[model samples]
Target: MDKQIGYGRWKAPADVMARAMARMRERERAGGPRKAVIGSGKEALAEAIRRYPNDPLRQLAMFLDASPLPALIGRAREVSAKTRTNHGDMLRGAIGDLKAINMKVQRLDQLNRRQVMALAAYWTHEKGQTPGTVANKLSALRKFFTQVGRQDVVPKREALYEALAVTGVSQQMVTRQQVALDTKAWTPKGVVPLEVIEEVRETYPHEALLMELMLAWGLRVSEALGLRPHSSDTPNFLLVHRETKGGRWRKVPYMKDAQKAAYQRDVLNRCRQWAEKSRRLEMGYPKLTLQQARSRLYNVMAEIGVTLEQRGVVCHGLRHEFAGDMFFDITRHRPPSENGADSDWYKQNKTLVADAYQQVSEALGHWRREISSAYLGSPTKMSKAQRERMEQSMQLIAGNPDVKQGLVAAGVEQFWITGPAADGVLLRAGEAMQVAGRFQEGWTAENLKQVHEVLRAGVARPIQFVVSLEAQPQGETLEIFLDR
Candidate 1:
């Protein structure tokens, strides 16, 4: 039988209109029409009915099965590849968390703000996750939703903020408290003791040289493995030419002091012996990948009765120990005494301590002194006057035309004069802010001497300066322009 539909047009009698109205009413009752499901319902129904003209139930089922999470998760994997760390693991964990909450959500648009908060609470209490971890997971989910153009699914920051403020709620809901925990207890713990090193040496004799490099020079496992000796005029010093994690080709000197030079020479000799031994045994050079090296080191450490996990330490602890030792050696200040009188030296030589940290940071292939704090504990705070003096010195050197001309002649386009030292000036250069050559800050005769020395040292680029005002008169005689 044919029925008269819109404008007296004859159409087959079917319950399509009734089914669509029922679906819309069900959605409206559930909460409200999902933005994706609103206009999509009619289109889906029409497409299904057109494809399966003889089946009415198939049309209804097809309209109800639409989901967006699976596609969004696929897109998330693509995004994770661009990150330095593995974000896929985090996403997988987030998915597991969603499943635990029994939201059974197929589409991102299905979950409301309240449901999201419930998941947060579940992670905080049932899963016993830290505030930072919870925040990070939520942030990852938020980023995913935003990328997939379903940002409305992400709970509002205000809602999360209010949830955190409520008392007697789940631990995860206390976001402010968790944030405080992150700030106060975010310090890295990596300081391997000497006894543990000895035990490791005994367990893995072949890796002794590598361990020594990490302890003495603070070399990462990769850096130590990639090292090859280079010929230099300074026989005592080992010329290490390697690409650091920061993507800079650095020429770091391994033997900077008499003690370090002696230790490094011994280690080099020992390495040669090990290579010769391996060749004799026909066991190829003891070359290892970074993971292999870390595994071997960890295995040896575990056998030595050292609980690295309990101590909150890792293979990098040797590097931390080196940084701490170097800081103390350079500053000649021990850890603060109970009465705090032992730190008086730090107050007296705040600039020197800062400079030492800067040097240590560079030695570790890092650009920032603040990072050194993780290894060598936090440095003593500097006074306003001390900071001003350092700034003044840098300005004095930068204001000198001769100094600027010297750098420009060396082909350096732009540079930052960090601070002044007794022997030279500390500076960072280029758009990357790499540590450039240290230029001497002194009297006219001394300054000219340093310029020649710097040029001889192959610093063909412009070098930043940090001179003192006391040397200004002598600097003026060098026909230098002193602007501003």
Candidate 2:
């Protein structure tokens, strides 16, 4: 049968309001997030917005208070702490967007094709909302309509994307391999220089500190805001206090470089002073709730032009730059961008590569090293530098008479070099060192005595080795020999 309000399938707005109030009463027996339920819901809802017929935001708040879709939608009818994070705020944002274009939509049911298109443009151009954010906002719109018995008002996804494209937010055309591999690199998205932080510090000192922490430790915004000033700092490391995504706890170290370390100390000291003066060390966000704190910081960021829409960079990009900078600091190599070394480097220096990824992942508070690939890049192809190094070494070694003879005989040989400056030559020939085997003549008593010396420790480490052979084999032609 067709739906009927307060009968079957559909509950009147007042009926939902009463049910939610009753739930709150039972839960005081558990708490409340939503607007307070007043005497006879619909009447109170109407009165709150009767004066603001032009303000859609006020009207939506009234609608949410009276209807509260969760009361009808969820099996639990519970208002979670994450309600704002997931859906509530997103819905509000969509309605408020109408105000930007001066549409004056008093009722959400009045949300028309013109308003939806305008919102898409606002989010895309004015707000610079990411594609993921845009999708979530659209979802919130659908949910609002679905519960309010106005699903037909929601625009098709294709139409929404088309509207977004008008504002230059085109649909992402990703290939199957790209989707499966997930190798989008965000390195050096743009450097957040010290001057930007200082400029923000002049107005919003605390928000600037959060940005500083983000750049210094690769902290997510929530993690930075949720720090315990006293306990977070060990002598060398900063423990993520709380509010981690997925509750991940990580310890980021004060940098090894002297200047970086000093800067870290300075930041910590300032944070400590601020916490002591304004809030207890334990009260990371102080009197402000999570929503209030986020709104305040984001407003400040926008004012200071910290957004991608404003400064051509967003706060999250700090984490990307940090990942890139951290990888370089640890491995002395650039993090993968559009052009970076592929698995060939990892193939040979597996341990080295693993260690670098491990340290960076830990510092960034990500459990898996693979997740870092989104911020740092994963190169699908060989880099020019790596390819050049390998080809140059291969050409040089392959051209040699001894190397060619060894290759012809057994495909591999015990290769070594004894030259005037053998150390420098070996250092320069890093890629060649993999094939450069240790020279040991047959197991004669004299050759056996050479055992304990253990020339280049772990030569199967297929790397560099430095040693002196007993009897000088004349010239540098002593490149390839048998493994005997």
Residue 74 error, candidate 2, Å: 25
Candidate 2: stretches off by over 4 Å: 1-192, 282-285, 338-347, 381-484
Give the TM-score (vs. native) of candidate 1: 0.40
**TM-score of model 2 relative to the true fold?**
0.43
**Candidate achieving the largest TM-score:** 2
- Judged by lDDT against the true structure, how good is candidate 2? 0.56
**For residue 448, what is the lDDT in candidate 1?**
45
User: Model-by-model lDDT, in order?
Assistant: 0.47, 0.56
Could you give the C-alpha RMSD of every candidate to the true structure, in order shown?
25.1, 18.5
Which window of 10 residues has the lowest lDDT sum in candidate 2?
174-183
